[model samples]
Target: MRYVKYAAIRKPTEECIFCKARDEVGKERENLVLFRAKYCLVMLNLFPYNTGHLMIAPYRHVPSLEQLSDEELTELMVLTKRCLKMLREVYRPDGFNIGINIGRVAGAGFEGHVHIHIVPRWNGDTNFMPVIAGTKVIPESVLDTYDTLIKYTHLLRE
Candidate 1:
C-alpha cells in the first residue's frame, strides 16, 4: 500500500513567502526553489496540483504582472520556459497547464503577489479523488521534486 504525506502548517506573517525566499540565501532546498535568475525565480508550489507544479515569481512583491518592469517581465518568461524544459526532461509529461490567475476572484491563492504557474499534465491525470474528497493526490513529495529539478537548473545557465 502507498500513502501520501501532507504537511500543513500555518505561518503567521505579513511577509510574503516569495519575498522571504528572495531575502534568504543558501536555503533553496528548504524553500523548494529550483533556480534564481536576475529578475525572476522558480519554486515548487507548496500546494501542488501535480508532481512538477512550479511557480515563477519576480523579486519585487507586486500584486499584478503589469507592475513588473520590462526586464522583470522578460526574465520571468525566460525562466518559466526554462522550468518547462526541466519539467519535460525530468517528468516527461504529455502536456502542461501554464497560466496566471490575476486576482482573488480569479482563484489566485497569492493574490497579493503575482506568479505564473507551470503545472505538468499527463494523459488521464484527473481522478475522482479530488472530486470526492477535495484533496489532490500528488505522487511525489515537494522536496523530492525539488531535488530532481534542481539538478537540471544548472543547464539553464549553460
Candidate 2:
C-alpha cells in the first residue's frame, strides 16, 4: 500500500477509496479483504457483529443502484450469492442481511457508489453489548478474517 501523508499529520489518501485498495495489493496488514474481481470486490468489515461480515462493491463508481446497468446488477447479485455461500461454508451463519444503501441517509458509509453488504447472523447473535453499550463485539480482527476468506475465494467462483 502506498503511503500518503498530508502535511505533518499523515493519513491514507482518500482520493478514491477503491483505488487505494487497488493500488496496495499486499500492503494492508489487515486480513479483512476476501476477493477482488474485475467488476467487484469483497472485504470483511472491520467492525462487524459476527466473525464474517463482507461488503461487495463495484469497480466503477456509481452512486445509485439506478445508475448500474442490468449486467452490473446481475453480476452484483451473483457475487452476493457467492459471498453468502462462502460465508456459510466458513462460519455457518444461520441467516444473512443482504442489501444496498442508496444514499447516506439510507446508511451508506460511502455514498459515491452503491455497494452491497452481506452480514452473517446466527441464532442469539445479538446481545447486551449492542443494547446496553451501543457497541458490537467482534471476536476476530479484520485482517485475520481477510486471510481466511482469501483462502476460500476459489470456492466462491465454483
lDDT on C-alpha atoms for all candidate structures: 0.83, 0.72
Give per-model TM-scores: 0.89, 0.82
State which candidate has the highest TM-score.
1
Q: Per-residue lDDT tens digits of candidate 2, residues 25-107?
A: 78543434567676776776555646888877777788887888887777888889988888899989899988788875776
State in Å the error of residue 156, model 1. Answer: 2.6
Q: Highest lDDT among the candidates is held by which one?
A: 1
Candidate 1 has its poorest 10 consecutive residues by lDDT at: 1-10
- Per-residue lDDT, model 2, residue 53, is 80
